[model samples]
Target: MKKNIVVTGGTGRFGNHLKSISTKHKLFFPTKNQFNILNFNSMLKYFNKTKPDIVIHLAGFSRPMELHEKDINKSINLNIIGTANVTMACSQKNIKLIYFSTNYVYPGINGNYNEDDPLKPFNNYAWSKLGGECSVKLYKNSLILRVCMTEKPFIHKKAFANVKTSFMYHDEVAKILFKLLNKQGIINIGGKAQYIYNFAKKENKKVKKIYQNKNMKIKVPFDSTINIKKLQKIVKVKF
Candidate 1:
């Protein structure tokens, strides 16, 4: 079945990879002019005109984790309020929604956090993402993906050896996305649990291993790996 799908934030890093994938469904990567998530009228107008079957809400504030701390208003408005607006539009139009969340929603102390596990966002950015999750959770036709994926080729020169996480490349996750389109509810999406350096070294052999020492400015999660058994059972996806 070739369904009409609308993807927000089509210009972002992961969105770019998702756009390149070969899927059976019809994907619409709308520019901000066509669909501005922060504005309810614009989102609703676009939804009414396009009449898409699925809305993948990817437009939100992310990266430079410091930005969230430095400017809380930007974080709350973009990630939280923007997502709520998308959810409202999707709910009104009776469209299926797939939200892109983060694995940082889980407590960093314990590894292998499940979907039902208690959520304790380790950073302000995670808090904003969780706030977005709250709105989508209310919509029955929504699917929340707590993904722990990163950019390909390992852009960073220094990798955290002491910090462990389930890091999958953008393309790997994009490949398995179409399979999960019809699914609803929360799901942990990630790769096998491993140290950051181990995953980075696979692509960049010269990547330096650096532990989060006392001098480190930012707070990095020690262990934020999620339990992806449910995702494996659902899609049989391999990273």
Candidate 2:
């Protein structure tokens, strides 16, 4: 059956990819004005009108990592309060909520974190997403995806040599997402564990590798790769 699906953040990098991959489902990609997630009343009205069976929540504070650190209020409002409003509306309407979280939520020191690992955010951005997870956990019909996805073909000319992460491209993650739409609860979505340079080299052999020193000022995780055995068992994919 082609169930109705609403994808928030339709214009975002990942959300846009979901639109292309979710052609089999009855998809509605609404702009913020059409369904302002920040406004509880607006969210309620939209849910009542659309009456979708599933809501893919990709809308949240991302990019310019500095934003989360500088404007803590906005990060809390968008990721936490916004998520609470959406989950509340979905619960009332009996709609399934699929949240897009980050792998940074896990303490980066531990390389392979499972679904049961305690959350220790590496930065304010991760903390905000974890805040959203808190609200979704309150709703029984919610699925939280702790994703470590990135752009394909090494979007950048230079890659970090020392940073290790489970980086899958936006398109690759999009396909897996469609396959696991029906499943619920927490799922860590990503690719194999490897250094940033090695992961990028797969797509672009010519990609330059620049090593980041331990004393570097950048506040990034050392090794935040997740254990994807459960994801593989469920989705039956090698990703």
Cα lDDT of all candidates, in order? 0.92, 0.88
Candidate 1 residue-wise lDDT, 25-139, digit = tens: 8898889988998888988888888889999889999989989999999999999999999999998999999999999999988799999999999999999999999999999
What is the overall TM-score of model 1 with all chains considered together?
Answer: 0.97
Clash count, predicted structure 2 = 0
Each prediction's TM-score versus the true structure: 0.97, 0.96
| Worst lDDT 10-window in candidate 2 | 15-24
The local lDDT score (0 to 100) that residue 84 gets in candidate 1 is 94
Q: Name the regions of candidate 2 deviating beyond 4 angstroms.
A: none
> How accurate locally is residue 14 in candidate 2, as Cα lDDT from 0 to 100?
88
lDDT of 2 by residue, 197-238 (tens): 999998899999888778767667889999998899977656
